[model samples]
Structures are given as C-alpha cells and as structure tokens.
Target chain A: MTFSDIPKFKLKEYSKAPELSSKTIAHKPVIIVGSGPVGLAAALDLAQKGHEVTILTAFDFIALGSKAICFAKQSLDIFDRLGIGERIIEKGVIWNIGKLFWKDQTNPVFQFDMLPVTNQKNPGFVNIQQYYVEDYLVDALEDMDNVDIRWGHSISDIEVRNDGARLDVDTRDGSYQIDADYVLACDGFRSKIRDSMGLDFEGRIFEDNFLIADIKFKGKAAEQRPSERWFWFDPPFCPGGTALLHKQPDDVWRLDFQLGWDIDREAVLKPENVEPYVKGMLGDDIEFEREWYSVYTFQCRRMNRFVHGPVIFVGDSAHLVSPFGARGANGGLSDAENIAWKLDLVMRGIAPRSLIESYNDERIMGADENIRNSSRSTDFMSPKNEQSLAFRNAVLELSNDYSFARPFINSGRLSTPTPYHDSPLSTVDNDEWDGGPKPGFPCVDAPVNDNEDSNWLLEKLGNDFKLLQFGGKAPESDLDVINIPIDSLAAQRYDAHHGATYLIRPDQVVAARWKEAQADDINGAYQRAIGAA
Target chain B: MDKFNDTVNISGHDDIYQMIVDLHADGNEEKSQKINAKLIIAMINQIGSEQIVKEIIEMVRLNEEKYNPRSSTH
Candidate 1:
C-alpha cells in the first residue's frame, strides 16, 4: 500500500494540559522532546526500567514519511530490548546482501554480505518505514502508566539550571512550564534546544543533492525482484550520477538518484522529472506508483558536546551524518540505549551522577566514527575537484576488470555498530583473551540451550549487569549469573577456552572479562562500570 | 644485501613495473604527473595499511633527500 492509503495515528489529547494544571510548574524526572523513533525509544527504555518519563512533541499524529527505512542489526537488538523487535522483524523486509554496479554494466562489480558473522539473534538489517518503528515505540510507551506523552506540546524555551532543566512548553491552546531533572533532545537536525543553548554543530557539508523517490511496484514484479540493496555508479539511466535502490515492506522500493549540484530542486521533484529516472532504472514496461519524493543535501555536522548541564542531546540533535550509510536512525537508537541505562541508574541512585559523563564520551566516539565513514563515502561519490574525479573514475574503471581495484570502489559503507573500546567506563584487560568482545565492545549473541530449550544469549542477559561465566560457578554476588557449558556455541563465540568470566554492563557492553573471576576483582569492575570507581 | 632482502611484497613484479613504465611512455610531464598521482592513490588504497604506507612515504622522502638534493632558485 502507498503512503496515502495508511491512516495517520492521531494521539489522544492531554486530559489536563500542564499549563492548565493547578501547580505553577509540573516536575518530572525525565522529559524527552520529539516523538520520533529515537525519542520514543529513549522514553520506552526509561519507562521500562521503572523511571517516570514525560514526552513532549509538537505533532499530534504520526508523521507520514518513509524516512530511515534501513534498521541495522544492532538497532534491531536494541528494539528487541525495548519490547518491539519481534513485531518490527515480522513486518519489515530483511536484507543482508548489497550489490554495487559500475557504469552500464548490468552485472555487479562486487557483492557483500552485511553479516559476516553468522547465527545471530537478529538479521543484518531490516527495512521498515520509520513510522512503524515510532508507532511501535509509542505503543509500548502508552502501555506503561509511568510515561506521559504530551502531544501538541512543543518546547519554546529551556533553562539549564544548576538543579535541573525548566522547559517552557507551548501547546495549541496555551503554554506550560515543566521542571525536569533531565531533558533529552531527540528532536531532529534543527534542534530547538541546541539553538536556544547557543551550541555549535560544526562539520563538513557535502555538495551534491539526492532526489529520493520511494515507489511501490505493482503486481508480481515486486516479489520477483531480489530483496537486496543495489547501488549503481554512472549507469545508463543516470550518467555521471549515483543511484541506490532498497526494498522496503509492502513492495515499496526506495530509489535515490544523485542530482548534480546545480539543479532546480522543485523541477526535479516534479513527477515528470522523477518518472523519467524511475523508468530509466525500472524500464518502460514496468507498472509502478510513486509514494513519496524528496530532495535533500546531507551534512556531517554534530555538537562538540552532547551533554550540557541538565539537558542532553540524543539522535540527530547530537550529530548528523550523510544518508549514504543509513547511520542516522541506527546511530540515534544506540544513543538512546546508551543514555537510557545511565539515566536509569542515576535516577535510582544506584550509580553516581558522573556516570552520565561517559554517555558524552562514548556517543561522541560513535558519532565521529559515523561521520568519518559517511564523509569518506560522500567524497568518493561526489569528488570535489577534477583530480579527485579522475581518481574516482580511475578506481571505478579499474574495478570493473581488476579484483584488487574493487576495494577502492566506494559506493557507500553500510552502517554497523561502532564499538566503544576507548570508553572510560570500561576496565582495561589484564587477562589474555585471544577472541571475544573486548572491554566496551557490544556483546556478541549466540545460541545456547536453556534447560534443554533453545535460547539466545543476548535475550537472556536482559537490561542489567550480568556475569556470563563459562564452565565454572561464579562467586556469590548480587549480580545475575549465567553459566554456560564449555562446548556450547556461546562459549566458542566468546572464545571461553578455560573457564572465562565476563562482566557485562546494563547496555550489554562488555565492561571487563577475566580468565578467572575473583570476588574483589568482580566487585571492582562492577564499580567501575557504574562509575563508582 | 640487506637492501635486496626484499621483505615487501611486489607480486607480479615485472608486469606491474612495466605498466608503470608504460604510463610515462610518450606522455608530457604534466600528464605523467597526473598519472603518477592517481597511481599513488590507487596503490595506497591497494596497500590498505596506514603503517606500511607511512613507512613507504618516509622511505621515498629519505631517498629524495639523499639522491636529489634541493637546488636554490639559481
């Protein structure tokens, strides 16, 4: 079905607007701005952890855009933790292979499997409309009584006080004041909070514009086509341009064509202009219908600091990368998961407030990685000077023939989880581990037998600190412990040769691991993970 | 003997060297320079190792200093 066929989900109006309440200012523990996927994910995460959250968004209904269709495996795992993974995986199209073509060649120069590591709980990537993700998060948030989603509420002004943050929220009828201990700005790239605070989002802006046309194929043609990402450089359809095609759910195909720097945006977006490119790629005989079309020039800019006093930036508000890598929403979800657990601990007084500082350090590293990758992809696709263009063309030309030159052909580097190996919260490794996720790396998932029934290692970890011990009994401690047999798949994936023990953080990141677990060392690592050390 | 020990990889040595020599055949200095620049970039990408590339760059710089001394604007 097309976008027009789907009905917008109108949010229920607040029974009593915060402005109309008796109190001059309503106080909340955590207030998240914008109800997009990132904001909603953060809200659901905090609420699931038993933290009271208030979501303030200006839109009363779900936005009708097919924005951010590719959700990576790490993001899907995050969604699984947030209680929406199964539904999304069921509805979304899963793809693991991507093919890159050069010039007029119908055959691909190279194809890559996004998931080099096999047998994980989630697939390499899922292509679902961003609205569905938002809807699922909102549905999960609505089920909890602790989450108060204030629709039609927009933050006009914010004050970062020594104690907390005070937001002047504007509604359709009136405005209200909300004093929140923390404010999460998941609002997209032009974040009002970032602007009001006078924070600089500095980075490189790419020079080419891409026209995105999400089209739905009619009849059996859609099902017959391969469900893999296909990218072309200088094809017969659009010469001297790059084109990308991704298969979304409901037979919807997202087609992006790089329109040169100097072109009429309005003229290109017109159906007459868009139809030619579509027909050129899909051929003249195929039947199709346009769902959505947009022209966007992406920038790789980000705030130097994501955390400012009582207010914190998440998702697009924190940083933005070019759309080539599909890192935008996926990276934002990581940010949400990163901050949610820290905030949960801080709110419960289980961890010190200084733990929140690690969020800045880690997510900034993640953002910089995304920026570096996307910027290189952008430079490869749209060379700035004649010399660069010659190099790009030389690579493309040589890649068609030589196997060695194919590695230089950069269409785009797909998004993956950026490991936080240098995080301050991670305890340095003293044990000699030949394999397995190192400190601050996201834990690997593997199949294991739980009481003669099959189970995934990641799902069993839950959203709290756990001790994954292999072939040995962990010492008595308050932390949850899971013992795995030495011959198990998880043991092999984790490279637990001789009774290894791992200290996993609440976000499923390996804080530390040891050949042998001692009570004092385990406690010290746990303390360091929670920023107590 | 140490210089000729040849720890570095130069697989398909003669063919690759011939291709590089052929690139300058009957070409002007400007065209040859452009070809060299592109070739260097492509080779660097082929190398794919920052440490090795840096070592190669330093070796080339030292060779230029020893063999081709800089002459003043005379």
Candidate 2:
C-alpha cells in the first residue's frame, strides 16, 4: 500500500490543573514531567500499581516525525505488560532479518537474524513510528481514572525538599505549584528539570551529523521491497558514509544518511540537495514524496547518578545515546519499568527509600552498556583517525571471503535487553545450572496454554513478584505462585528439568532461582530482592 | 605436507581492535608506539612462552621486511 499523505495528529490546547479546596498547592503522589514514551509508560505502570499519577507535558499533541522507528522485542514485551502491545504490533512492520551491504554490492556482505532464541511472542523488532506509540499510550492512560495527563504544562522551577520536591509549573491557563512526592524527569535531551536542578551528564558527543529523509515511494516499487532493515557502508550512492533504510507502517520509509562533520547543515538539508541521494538509492524512475526531513547530531551521555533526592531522572533526562542502536527509546522504557515498580514499593512503605538506590546502580549499569555499544558502533561507522579507518576497512574487506571478520563489521549493534549481571537486587545463584536465564536477567518467554487458550509465560507472569514453580503445587506464601509442568517449552527454556523454581521480580526480571524451593531461602531472597534484607 | 590451524584466537576481536585504535585517537605516534611496546611486553608475559614469542617476533620481522624492505629492522 502506498501512502503519499503524511499522518496528521490533532494538537490539544492546555488545561489547568484542578483547583483544590483545602490546599492552595496541589499535592500529587507522582508528577511525571514529559509526555514521551518513557513518561507515559512510567505513568501507566505506576497508575496500574494503584498510585495517583499526573503526567505533565510541554507539547499538547502527539509528536510529529517518525522518530525512534525501531522498537526492540524487549520494548514490545514491556508494551504488552502495559496493555498496548497488540495495537503496536498490529500497526508496526515486524522485521527480524537485517541485511548489511558493503559498497555497491547487490548481495549483502553479512546478514543477521535479530532473534537467535525463538518461540517468543514478539518478533526481534517492530518498525513503528514513535508518535503512534505515544498516541496509543496516551489513549490507554486516558482510560485509567488515576492517570491525569496535563497538556502544555512545563516546569519553570523546582525546589528539592527532604520529603519530596515542589515544582513551579507554567501552563497555558496560568502558573501553579505542585507538591509531588516524586518527580520523574522524562523530559528529552534538553531536560528542563535536569537543567533547573543544576545537574549535567558525563558522556561523549560524537562528531558526525545524520540527515533523516522519511519518504514514501509511488507505484509498486514501495510494496515490492521487503520490510527488512537495509544498511549500506560506503555505498556508491553515498560514498565514504553510511546509509540505513527502514520501513514503517503506511508505506512510510526512513532513510538515514551519515554526513561527515565538515558539511554545511543548511545546504545539506535542502530538498534539492537531498533529492539526488534519494534518487541514487531508489532509482530515478521511482517516484517518491518527502514526508519529513531532519538533520540531527547525537551524543552518548548520562547523568552521574539518575537519582537526586526525591527527583529521579528517566529516559533522555537520565541518559542519551547515539541513535544507531535504537537504545535511546528502548533504554528509556527499561528505565521507566525499573523505577515504576521500585517507586511503587517505596511509596507503599513496603520497602525503604534506599531501595531506589538500586534503581540508580542498575540503570547506570544499563546506561553504561548502551553507551559502550553505541560508542563502539559510532567509532566503527565514523572512524576517529586513519588507524581506526584502516581497521574498519580491513574488517569490511576481509568479510567478503572470511566469515570470522564479518562479526567485526558492525553497521550498528541492534538493541537487546541488558542483563544486570552484577545488580545488587539479584540474589546470586546457589545451585549450578546448565542453560537458563540466570539471576539479574530478563525472563525468556515461551508459548504456553492456560486452560485451552494459548498465552505467553511472560503474560502469565504479569508485573508482579511471583514464584514460578515447575512440576510442583502452589507453595504457601504471600507471593503469587505460577505452577507449570516440567514437560513444557517454558520449562525447557528455563531449564526446569529437576523442578527448578524462579523468583521473578515485578519487572519480570529473575531475582533468584533455586534447584528446590526452601522456605527460609525464599524468604531471604525475597527480602533481598525488595531491598528489605 | 604441513597442516595449519587457521582459527581465530581473539575473543571479542572487534573490541580489542577498538581499544587499540582508541589508544591512538590523540594521533600521538610516539606515545602510541611506547604504549604499544608496553602492551606487547605485558601480552608476552601473559603468553608466557619464550619460543612462541621468538617465533612471533621472527614472523613479524619477516612480514615487515617483505612489505617495506627499506624500513626493515634487521
């Protein structure tokens, strides 16, 4: 299907925060600043956990432009937990194969399947425009009575109190003060909350610019092309640079061309200048209309610490990375999930405030992993020096004949769930295992049957701390227990042959696993997982 | 006839190459050369074999001689 017209979103006008009778300043349990995917996800998770959430955003409407187009499987699973996964998957173009071409070769020098371990409900990735995700999340949030999304609200100033933080918000209606028990700074790269608090990030700013040309082709050519990620390194069309092509829903395609640091941004962004490059890739005979054109430079940076007093930074407010790995949005969603569950426990007095410290430690580990991978990809794509360039060239040159060198030719390492190997929240393994998800790793999903209906194991796990017991009856405990037979795919994936039991955290991370469940050990590990030990 | 084991030895080869390339990001030839010398010594210690080190040095010298005869070290 060829869609020539760009999708238009309805922009909303600002509304005032409701006036309170007793308190002049409105007190909110949680005030999340920013209406992006991260903020929305956090608000949804928290609201579902039975907390009142007020999400404030500067923009009145869904974001324009097909930004952050690739949604990883981990992100899809999170969206499933949020109840919008089906809608996203329905609208998105599912792709598992990525073809990497070197130079003008018609055949790919290297190809990869994003999902090595299969039988999961979600694919390796879904190429959907970011606006659709935000719009759907906003729709879901509107249905919940506890989530109040305030449009056109921006924080002008913030005062950090020992108990919580007070925000001076500027809205279209007027200015007001909001005393929030917790403030989630999900604001983008230029976060007002982070800036107001006099906090900054420690990271590297890559020295290259990329021009994104989102276009829709006419005729049958657009439909004929496979919906797979196509990347070209030093192609004849854009010599000495990298080019990426991804297909989004409604026949909208994203074309990213890496322009070196020396080019004039103004001239390069011109339609006349960009048309030739588009024609070079999709032959001159193919007719296409420009939907969106943008020029962007990226950085890999994160705050020294994500947590500061009662105010916590999430999403781009906490960390930023080059867009190569699609880690920016995916990592932010992980941050949202991580803080949402922990913040819920702390708010309910089930766990101490110090439990939030683990969020900082674990997310920092995730951010560092993202930065390291993104930085390496950047260095591989845009070589800093002649020596580095030579190494890159050697890797590419040797990849044609030698299979060993192909792994080194990194166009971009696609996003994967970061396993918190050294997370303090995890209870280390007490028993030896051959192959299964270890503590501090996200749980693997497998097809399972509930009664006669088919479902996923993660779906059954939901967003709670549950005891997954294989081939055993429900144990006597306050924690939720899910029992399954040992002869299932889930048991095989979890290596539950000898009746293994796992303690799954609220965020679906395996906190601890045992060869056999013991009451004393389960209690100890559960306490440790919740930061109560 | 002689058989050769043409297997890739380095695990995470790209990262090792990146680390080496990053060391030269400043474009300081002398500093990189000295650092590389130190790295080689440290790696030789890790290898912990006199005969293997000698054989590698000879192979490198031969390759260097074949590539750039005028700049050869011996």
TM-score per candidate: 0.92, 0.87
RMSD of each: 4.1, 8.2
Model 1 per-residue lDDT tens digits across residues B1-74: 11222276558988988988998998786566567766876777766777778777788888998999788677
Q: Write the per-residue lDDT of candidate 2 for residues A136-219, one digit (tens) a residue.
A: 998998999998888878789999997799998876667778899899999988999999999999979888989999998756
Runs with alpha carbons beyond 4 Å of true place in candidate 2: A1-8, A19-23, A449-452, B1-74
Which docking class does model 1 fall in? Answer: acceptable
Pairs with backbone N, CA or C atoms under 3 Å apart (clashes), candidate 1: none
lDDT of 1 by residue, A2-57 (tens): 23553464544544484566666778888999988999999999999998899998
TM-score of chain A of each: 0.97, 0.97
Chain B TM-score per candidate, please: 0.69, 0.76
| Backbone collisions counted per model | 0, 0
